[model samples]
Target: MTTSPPASATPALPEPTPTQSEQYSLTHGKLTVGDYLPKASHDGKPGAGKCEWSSHVSVALTSDEIGALAWVLIDSVMKARFGPAVQLYDVWREHTLDGTTIPEPDRQTIGSFVKPVFGLPGADKKKSKDHLHGHIGEWLWHLLTKDNPTVRAQPAPKGDVTDSGGDGYTIYETANSELRFRLWESKKNTGKGSLSTSLNQAYGQLGEHGQTYVAKIVGAYAQASGEGAAELNSFITEIPRAWTQGDVIVGAGVTLATHRPLPNKPFKKMAGKLPLLDKPGQLRGLATSIECYEELADTVRRYAWTAL
Candidate 1:
């Protein structure tokens, strides 16, 4: 067998020359959206004020682009659950300080949607209000404006820090556990629900065996029948993090309407969506292959896996 080249000077990812479509990854704070909802937030229930917390995602794409992504989000939602939820979010981004609305002519590109989760061994175990819908807005603002880098937690605790504060949701993570499109931590209640407890509580609702793909596209809240993914015994699995290394990411699913489903494509398209786990000899090298990363993403998109 041919020996791999000496480990040195891996080629760097090419910097794409500036294009109108590529405007510095569109920092949320700089964009009209940030003026509306600057950071990931727990704005709590929906309201009549400029912002609404109904199930949704805050996308950074133009109107047309939103439509394409919406289509895909809807597709993934359908495949994940029996069908789409009662309402979908499109149009009506929060109003900016200057009192202008960020046009979401196609509002479906922020990311996937998730259902409101409830019913675990020790959770309240009661139905919540319609106000509890879920969300999945882009972490654009934080990565663009905030001095601190965006964060993500890994396996056992597996989630990307797609947190753009002021928007109302963040994802917490774990190994073999499905990532949570989380709510901003609340200092209001303390007991089983300080920040850490509340997160763990929400995670358990998805159930250990669920492969449901239905999640709110922008913010959390969609209580329906379903199961939770897995749970890691340790509170500290892979802690929250950011991408220190570079990797490529490609859209796995399709986009549609002003809103669509999220990624859940075949295995070979979404692997590097997050950091890879370096399992011994076999699982190590494959991490570098985009196809493998894509496959890994596809494999886990359904639901977090549980130990047998």
Candidate 2:
């Protein structure tokens, strides 16, 4: 009864500001997403301190050892088109540029060539999880592991006593998975540089549980560190920039088999939960299929060796 006219109704609270999209240009001028360029056009040349990652080839899989991953997947709703595989070389031979071999992987040949199940599941699923999983224990106990390639034995010049040193390797997706292991090719000949393989020594470089859901690229790009100096140069400069470079919206140019996956927005908003597969390029960056797998092999093949 005391107050004159009711105080002027307060203006309705301004609608909350919209989120800055990572995929498209922003509507309001002030905000924006990272780059959305193609993977090839973004990642610039890595300098000495920047940690360059070049290889003759790369292969990605969604697997827990026992070889490349076997995802129960297909490619029908395919939208973000994959670039055609550059037909410069035969994919298989290209993958072997670093002297690695898949061998004549028919059933018989593969059986003999397989070193051992190692940390992966056995050809038999139940047995694999029970036996191999147990044996791997603390080391391979990560949620999203990868079998990244490294030189089994560092190749020597001519035949200087022929020291058969090999590359080491390791798995990542969580925890100390970035570890490397060195092993000898000729365990009996224990010379100074004896042949051996071990996990890469970068385990401590990342967080025990890094955020990137790298466990997805299983369908294609077996995560081979096999890009050639130049081809790798092409990728770093192009894709990373598109995926997450400067002003433009970059593609993140991540491979499908990267241990980390991209993040998703729409799903999180509606479901009120964050999903590993919800990330932008999370499920994977590459398309998966028999052909694409082979194409990945081809791409690595071409990148590894120039003549091929």
Candidate 3:
């Protein structure tokens, strides 16, 4: 008879081999993603209509929601580059105002606020994935779940930031007082490949490295001040054990082709094999599929140019 391997002898998960990336040049005042339904046919017929998505899922593009998202993105960017407790308005004014005595930001100033995040040369370059991933994280924070500034501010680095790991993390209290940790990962497909490709990449990222990244960031924040810093710090020290002993939830955000229809049934069938951490009898396996216009980045830039 064979004996079971000891805990230490158990192998850590393997690293994820993400798909090859493509590079695209950034265009000014252009958007690459937005509301658009992909072309689909029922029984070999082509048509246009509302694509049925998972229940209760929709994107908010109203002025109010866009403005809120802008603020959050700006604040999160600053907090990640600098630290928490930063006043984003001041930072925006500092960079855009250039010593002017403007009490409030105008349209031009608003564009300036987002330039670092979206305006820089090649910010949304063809191969870049950070912008899409970071934006999805922000979208989930505001639209689906309660806000967590630290996770949102996790910095969309211009380069080499994806390796920074732990796209996002949050803590929740169960009815019985047990703690559960939720982690998120995102993938964007520029229509060069099927949506399934991006979804698979996201699921792989979460399974391979989500826990380690969360533990690292949580440990850092735990030493500082925040809503759950102290508790997170203690949890980090315990690590693999802490994660296994308690509940851990994983979320994946996939950006798919907007021109084609995505049926929920087949999508679920495909995702069934993912190594999600959502436990039995617990809310787990959170995901969102975003269909973007061909010019989402341009649209966002125009919005910022007009709104700020």
Q: Pick the candidate with the highest lDDT.
A: 3
lDDT computed for candidate 2: 0.20
**Which order, best to worst by TM-score?**
3, 2, 1
Cα lDDT computed for each candidate against the true fold: 0.23, 0.20, 0.40
Off by over 4 Å in 3: 1-88, 91-138, 141-143, 148-161, 224-232, 244-262, 265-278, 281-283, 287-296, 302-308
Query: Could you tell me how far off, in angstroms, the CA of residue 12 lies in candidate 3 after the best superposition?
Result: 55
Residue 117 lDDT in candidate 3: 40
RMSD in angstroms between candidate 3 and the native structure over all alpha carbons: 18.5
Model 1 Cα lDDT, one tens digit per residue, 31-77: 33233223332224322111122112333444323322332322333
The worst-scoring run of ten residues by lDDT in candidate 1 lies at: 281-290
Best by TM-score: 3
Minimum summed lDDT over a 10-residue window in model 3 is located at 16-25
Number of clashing pairs per prediction, in order: 78, 89, 27
On residues 190-281, what C-alpha lDDT tens digit does candidate 3 reach at each position? 45667677666665665566567666666565353687667655654554554554344323332232323444532342234333433442
Cα RMSD (angstroms) for every candidate in the order listed: 23.6, 23.8, 18.5
Ranking by lDDT: 3, 1, 2
Compute each candidate's TM-score over C-alphas. 0.18, 0.19, 0.52
lDDT value, candidate 1, whole model: 0.23
